[model samples]
Target: MGLSFDYALLNLGRRPTRTVLTAVSSALVAALLVCTAAFVRGLEQSFTGAAQPDVALLLSRVAEGDVLRSSVQAGLGALVRANVPGVAVVSEEVHLACNVTVPGSDGARAAMVRGVTPAAYQVHDAVTLTEGTLPGPGEVLVGRLLARQMRVDPSRLAVGETLVLEGAKHRVSGHFAAPGTAIEAEMWTPLEALRGIARRPDASVVFARLEPGADARALQLFVDRRLDLELSLLTSEQYYADLARYLAPIRALAMAMAALIAGAAFLGGVNTAAAAVQDRIRELATLRALGFSTGALWRSLAQEAVLLGSFGALLGLAAARLFLDGGAVRLAMGAFTLGVDGPALALATVATLALALLGTLPALLRLHRLPIAAALAED
Candidate 1:
């Protein structure tokens, strides 16, 4: 049978308010889906991108997965370098999660403070010295995205500004960037200075870079041989992978909210479609009596659903561009920007159309087997 959308197009005009409401409901669901997809994608990309395949962390197993709580002997780096054959360089780094204040700013903000040696530059090659100079005894250098991650004023972290940490003042020496990594939100200072500030002689961890093609199993074996060290070997990839799993609940929660809104949209679509059929029973019966095929009638209903879905998809994309795109979301590790890329947009659009198309099922079934004689005789 031939299909036509002329009657479907005209039907939408019969009750303009209902048509608008149905489209708006679909838009809300689509907007939630697009934003959730963007959030989940950005979160995974940032966490996974931060990992280095060959670098390993030597930390106390007691600290579990928290690097900030780890404590390894300061001399462990030297021992590892001497014992391990393929070890290129080892950096004894300290990680401190603490609050900091700007000299003139009133409130304090949380910051990730890392104490590093010059060898850290060799191990963490992803880091680059972008501006000013290396941090000296009483100064610190910040990452490029530190201000945004910390939600502080850019001037407060400028090259020449002073940052207060635990009642002590330290100058901001420079800002560096480690693209696609969580490292770009921390403040780095000299190891010796942080040792004095934190009043702990132990280093947080010994981050070691292995030579190309070297096995990380050797590092674990080294730890195994010396139970006295109490150090556990964790590769950078393993650390980030564990971090992503820990944060999985957050992504699930976002998708769950989107699913709830989608259910609401589906119900709205069904209500709208059922109402349209009920209002036009007599008119529809007349068409059936006049020789219009059941396939043509079903196609017309499908057309209306598609139109609503398409319009709503576009509206949702517009909402995502206005609100979620380029938006920063803060997490325990760091912050990442929500990106509404092509894949996210496409997925959300498809979901909207599918939900709309499925909603026509009940209405189509009723109209398909309608008793034309009774429908025409009714008031």
Candidate 2:
């Protein structure tokens, strides 16, 4: 005979404290799993989504993936504009990944400084000035999200504030925003001023916009054939996509840590389940004597574990939604919001259920080994 649904539920209530503790432990594991997965996935999406599909990024052939390390003659922008067909706009840019000390503090934080011209505004149309104006020589425009990325006060990045970069004092001319993109974490300065400060004679990358109806493939091929230029071309979308792949190791580490945490939680749950089953041996043996099949006994216990897991998962997801969702996590590359999207929630659900069933296995094995008469005779 199969146990009634009420019978399974009542079993959990028989030891309410144990049941609550186990569920809470599982909930913590679920929260950790969801947050970790969401953080990595959000970072990947933020980076890959930053690229505009209508533009192409030209990098030095020697530094294909490392834009900060790449250097191409500043004059190359003019050359490309003059020679490359279907190119409507060309913006020369210099990128440097450096650390800057916070104002009035000895603490330092990493920052990406970009040297750009007015043409850059046209190429990256998503950027919009929120305060003050575009940067002029000796001035810089800070991304609206830069303060958050650097984990500093937003007022420190306000217009008129000065930030020392490479030992050069540069006033913050404005604040700009480019939501959901890596650009939101960068600081922009005038091309000439940044070159002088960074002591670089060349630009890091060239951005080119294609005219409507123009063939991106043909433009890429044209750059590829320019052996004298020694340049590599990638669509802006492809560039950010490549950047996401470059940061895969960090994401992998996050996933591994989440797995380790979940494994520990699972072990804790196993111990709880084993103790609960040990206490209920006589009850289970009495059911067996009442014509309950072994499969029915197993199913009843499994149902209880799953029910506990489901409740825990709900609590964990709620906690994550309240605390983690939309929260920004800063990395070496930039800041990405923690996303508790559908996939992350679904994964948490599956992990919770799996842990519930797998964690109960030891208890089930112990049940199978107990002699019916001996189990019922226990005090």
Top candidate when judged by TM-score against the true structure = 1
Residue 176 lDDT, candidate 1, scale 0-100: 88
Candidate 1, residues 260-299, lDDT tens digits: the string is 8778777877877788788888988988999987767767
The local distance difference test score of model 1 is: 0.85
The Cα error of candidate 1 at residue 110, in Å, is 2.3
- After TM-score superposition, the amount by which residue 362's alpha carbon in candidate 1 deviates from its true location, in angstroms, is 2.2
Q: Give the TM-score of candidate 1.
A: 0.89
Residue 213 local lDDT, model 1: 91
- Give each model a TM-score: 0.89, 0.87
Residue 64 accuracy (lDDT) in model 2: 64
